[model samples]
Target chain A: MTGDEACAEGALAAGCKFFGGYPITPATEIAEHIAKRLPQVGGVFIQMEDEIAAMASVLGASWAGVKSMTATSGPGFSLMLENIGLGICTETPCVVVNVQRAGPSTGLPTLGAQSDMMQARWGSHGHYEIIALSPSSPQEIFYQTITAFNLSEMYRLPVLIMTDEIIGHMSERVVIPEASEIQLFNRIKPEEKSMPYWPYIPGADGVSPMAVAGEGYRFHITGLTHDEKGYPVMSAEAHVHMVERITEKIKRNISHIIDTEGYYLEDAEIVVVSYGVSSRTSLSAVYEARSMGIKAGLLRLKTVWPFPEAILRTLASRVKGFVTVEINLGQIHLEVQRCVGGNVPTFFVGHAGGTIIPPEHVLSVLKDAF
Target chain B: MSIQSDQSDQQTHPLDDLLRKDRIPHIWCPGCGIGTAFSACLYAIKSSKLDLDHVSMVSGIGCSGRGAGYINLDSFHTTHGRAIPFATGLKLANPDLTVVVFSGDGDLFAIGGNHFIHAARRNMDLTVICVNNLNYGMTGGQVAATTPHLAKTTTTPAGNPETPFNLPLLAYASGATYVARWTILHTRDLTESIGEAIQKKGFSFIEVLAPCPVNYGRRNKLKPLDVLRIYQEKSIIKHFASPSELHLDLEKGITLGKFVDQDKPTWLDMYYKTTRKKS
Candidate 1:
């Protein structure tokens, strides 16, 4: 299956019944495949007016208690930020797939680059925690889509699967797991009904069970600083409680959410940090450096947010230095630097728009680091 | 004596008491038509007899968007200009729930313009109440898509050079099954129109000509009541007016009444029926 077909398959596996999006290069295939496949499976596929409406519709569908998703690229991703924040604030669970192309704005629609890492995290207004995953292969996209949906349902927050253009447009062999083999997570439902349901109320695990509209649960939700009842409460206390609950829900449970893949990091002197398609290149570079007798390894990030900071701190103590590589102008590199806390010297091999860094470029960085 | 009897008859309806009384020293300025429009919504909701629990009121950012928070229903005060799309999702996810979008002209026709047209075109089963105030009152009286040509507003100091949108006409063209327009002053008519729109099965749009006393007042040189009276006098029933003559001019604001209405399969109905047939 192609990467785009894998995403559609992933959505189906994750029980996504609704997809609302407009077509853009690279990401357009995801919409096309889903459009053809969804209706046959009793799902909906709408070609929205623009990326903004696409993102908004997904958010709305999620609140109606259906698993929903939208796919977009650079400009579309930027348009989606405001409503994505609404999803964050409202604790609506949904998935957004950004098949990264080049550009500050429509830079390279058909090309590939992982330039949207930071924007995916902080592009929306105000402060909040987000869950973003990166896929290096078509198979990873299939699995990561399932993970994104599970995390979204678990935390009641929007989860992003940040795929570069290469991976989104790439064709590869992907196994469609039998339904019994794939794990599914449904949003927690209330034990009682007809009583006051606090949509934002955090459980001991920091995630509140979600109740859908028309489920006989009377609920009020607002974009303003709200109380447990979901009504707008203007006060320092209300702000503190609401913000703390949503942010803390994800923060306190970081251990369960954070995921990373390590290669030869057990006794390596230098570690190459990467994610998305760059991770594939980093893997080859690590082998090249190792064959040259340089003690280099790779820390492939699967969960980009709630970033494996603890793992980086542990790696920094053992490794001589960490070299971060991505297709952006040093966004995630800053997070790496902050997490390492100057313990290990950090270096960045970055590009912008739709250009991917060569394996040789990453190998040279590892060679120099050692 | 007949008027008294009519009033008594209206009071006998079940939704007569749901109107918020204390908020009654209403926030809208005196003569502002939003109060009557608000009452019309309340009366419509009351008359539908749908469970308030099954109805969710969603609004975007604007004076009318504030209606979501004020109204006593399962409400969502969402981001600006995205209410219809948001409500579209809400309705599709749970076809059993009644999702209504309440937004101002600026929020619905300008920022939210795409959503409005698409939702109408899709014939999503949702009720959209667009309170067309001519100007962006909440953001300061700026010209909106629905603002009349050469109309004076804060942004259009000399005159609004751009052509104003005819909301009902646009909605009808976009495939809305039920389309209606009413002024705030025509409380009874507006209320009945709203009820009719709600009862319709497919995408329904009611463009209520709400008065903006604070910002639009100084420019239009009319109080809210004046705007209401204009609606009463100018509006002709849809059956009476010719389609070509329906164009309204800002200088001499024209007809206001229910326009296009036809039964069509709603998005949900089509979706479910297709699914069942396949099975």
Candidate 2:
């Protein structure tokens, strides 16, 4: 299966009942696959007018007590930013798959890039936290897509599955697990006897047990800075309390959300940190450098946002220096430097972005960083 | 407008039960006509044969956007100009849901105009209640897509230069199965129109000419009641009027009545039929 095909399958396995998307390159296959399959499973698939409406529809269905998702590339993802903020503010649980293609503005549609890494973190206009995953292969995208939905539901955050054209188009064997093996979860629901349930009021776990429409739990949801009762409350105090709850939920649960894979980090003199397709190249470079008797290791990030600060901080103290490889000019490199906190040098190895950084280039950066 | 009063006083209306009494004394200016439009919607819902639990209200940002927040239903207050698509999702997901998109002129026709035409074009099953106050009311009487030509507005202090949309004509042209126009003064007619639109199968549009006293009225030199009086004297009930005849003429008269009433296959029905036949 291709990465995009695996992503749709993953969503179906995760019990996503609604797929609302606009067709864009590298990401269109995800929508197409789901559109054909959703009807068979008693789910809905709608090709919305535009990406903005697609994003809005996803949030609407999620609030209507169903797991929903949407897929887009750069321009489409850009249009989705406003409603992504809406999803965050309203705490709507859904997945947004940005199968990234090259762009400043349709720069290269049929090619791969990691240009949207920073946008995923801060594209929406507000102070907030986001959860994003990077998949290096078709098989991994399948797993990460499911993980994205699970985390979105668990944290009440809109999780992003960030893949690029190379991975999204690459075909490979993806093992499908039995239905019983997959863990499925809906949002925590308020008990029947809990009359007058304040929908926005989170429990001790900092997640509100949601109630869907037409369930007789007549509740209000808004995109404004709202009070616990979901009423629009415009004040600094309300703003502080509301923003804190959203940001802190992910901050406190960092242990569960962050996923990373380290390749031979023990006693390494130089480390190459990367994610998505770049990680595969970085791993190859690390092996090539090892064959040449260099003490180099590779760190692959599965979860990009919430940046694995503690692990990077610890690795920075031990390693001599770091080399970061990505398709963009420098997106995740900045995060790595921030997490490293100037303990050691962090060298960037990247392309302006229509193609991937080669292993040889990553090797040179690894050698030069030391 | 549903107040949290004693049981005896509340017994006068069924709308009280379908209202969030705590959020009463809403932000609309006193004598603003959104209250009347909202009342008409509630009465329509009450009088309609649809199940109350199966109805959901979706609204976008504006004065009228507060409709979802106050209504005692599964309400969603979405972002600006997006109520139609949001409600579209709800209807498609649960075809059993009677999804209503309630919003304002700027929200429905300007930033969200594409959604309106497209939803109508698809013949999506939705009841769209657009409160047209001739300008962006909550934003302090700025010019909008529905602002009448030569109308006074904050953004158009010298008078609006852009041609405003003829809402009924636009809805009719966009293939809305049922299209109607009404004013707050025509409560009986508006209520009956809303009830009928709610029962219509495919895309239904009801445009309410509301009075935004603080924002729109102050600029146009008309008080809230002046607009109501204008509706009584200057409006002509022209049911089955041609789409071209529904244009607003502040002095001459605005056509008031259902302009289009017809049936067509909805987006979902075609989708299922085509996909099912292929499969």
Candidate 3:
């Protein structure tokens, strides 16, 4: 199956009951598959008029107590930005899949790039933490999408499956485990005995129990800077408390959210960092460079938004230098530079979109880094 | 009449059980009619006799949008211009809930115009009530899609040159199963109409000609009561009026009534039939 199809299958496995999406290149397969399969499972698949409505519908479905998601590419993701912020402020639990294609604006619809890595973090117009996962292949995307949904439900925020067009369109064998083996999470529901629910008050994990519509809580939720009671309170004090709690919830739990795979670094002098489809080539390059006795290692990032800062900071002391490889020109590279903090020199092996960064090019950058 | 019978206590106010009293002294200005429109909605909800637990109200960003937050119902205050689609999701996901979208004209027609037309075209199961104050009330009197052609607004000090949408005609043409128009002066009638809308199947729309006293009224030199009086004097109640004959102009007589009431299969009904056949 293709990565997009695998993603749809993964969502089904994760108990996603609603699929709201627009057909964008590199991501339409996810929608097409869901539109066909969702009905069989008593789920809903709505091809909304546009990506904005798709995203808005997803949030509404989430509030209606259904697990929901939407898939899109660059243009559609741009359109969904405003509502993504709404999801954050209201803390609506849902998933957003961006099968990334090249773009500032329609740069390369049919082709691949990791250009949206930065946008996924800062696309919405506000200060908020985001969870984004990058997958190297169809199999990984399938698993990562399920993981994405789990984290979204646990954190009560939008989680992104940030895969590139190469992986999104590429066909590969994916392992589907029995449904029971795949751990699922439902949003924490308020205790029925607990009346007059304060919907935004954080539990010990800093995630509040959510109330769905028609449950008789008469719960209110809004995108405005709100109080713990979930009513709009436009005061500086309310803004401070609200933003602090949402941001701090993720910040304090970085150990649980950030995921990275290390190829080798115990005795290596150089490391190459990459994500999405670029990580696949980076792994091959690391293996080839090791055969040539270059002592190169691969640090494949699975979670891109949190940026695996602590791990990168620790690795900076061991490795002499780093090569950040991605499709976009120096997006994750800038984060690599920020993490290494000028202790070790960092090199960028990058492309301008519409194509992948070849292994040889990344290998050469690794040599230059050394 | 006894004084005690006439003067009820604050706790005795109707719909108090359905209101968030702590949210009182709402943001609406003294003479703004959004409050009356809001009251009518609650009254209609009560009259409809639907289980309060099975009701959800959704709204976008505007002065009228504030209605959802104050109503003690399962409510969502979503982003600007998004209430209809959001409400669509709610209704579709759980067919048991009575989903309603309450917002202003600018929110429903200007920024969210495509959704309005498409939702109506699909004949989705939802109630959409738009308070048409002829301007963007929350944003302070910017000319709106429903603004009169020669009206003065903060953004149109030179007077609005663009022709406004005739809302009743637009809703009737957009495949709404039930459509009506009224003003705050027609409270009991508006309440009854909303009750009828809630009971109707497919998409139902009500356009309430409301007042934006602080922004629109200050500029036009008309109070909220003045607008209601105008609604009383110049409005003609023409039931099942032709869409072409229902154009509203501030300088001309306003045609008001239930212009469209007919049955049609909704989006979900067709969706289910087709999907089931295919499966």
Number of the top candidate by lDDT? 3
Model 3 regions more than 4 Å off: B1-10
Pairs with backbone N, CA or C atoms under 3 Å apart (clashes), candidate 1: A102-A353, A102-A354, A103-A353
Model 2 lDDT, residue B49, Cα = 75
Candidate 1 shows a clash count of 3
Instruction: Summing lDDT over every window of 10 consecutive residues in candidate 1 chain B, give the lowest-scoring window.
Output: B15-24
The alpha-carbon lDDT assigned to residue B222 of candidate 1 equals: 75
Model 1 chain A weakest lDDT span, ten residues long: A193-202
| DockQ, 0 to 1 scale, candidate 2 | 0.72
Candidate 3 residue pairs that clash:
none
TM-score of chain B of each: 0.87, 0.95, 0.95
For residues A162-238, could you state the per-residue lDDT of candidate 1 as single tens digits? 99899988899999999899999998887685366777777779887777777666566778888777767779998
**Candidate 2 residue lDDT tens string, B1-279:** 786767674454568878887888778889899989998999998889778888999999999998998888889999999999888888887788899888998999999999999999999999999998988888778999988888899999999999989998899899999999999999899999999999999999999999999998899899988888889888999999998877577767989999899989999998888777853
lDDT of 3 by residue, A43-68 (tens): 88988888989999999999999999
Worst 10 residues of 3 chain B by lDDT: B2-11
Clashes of each: 3, 0, 0
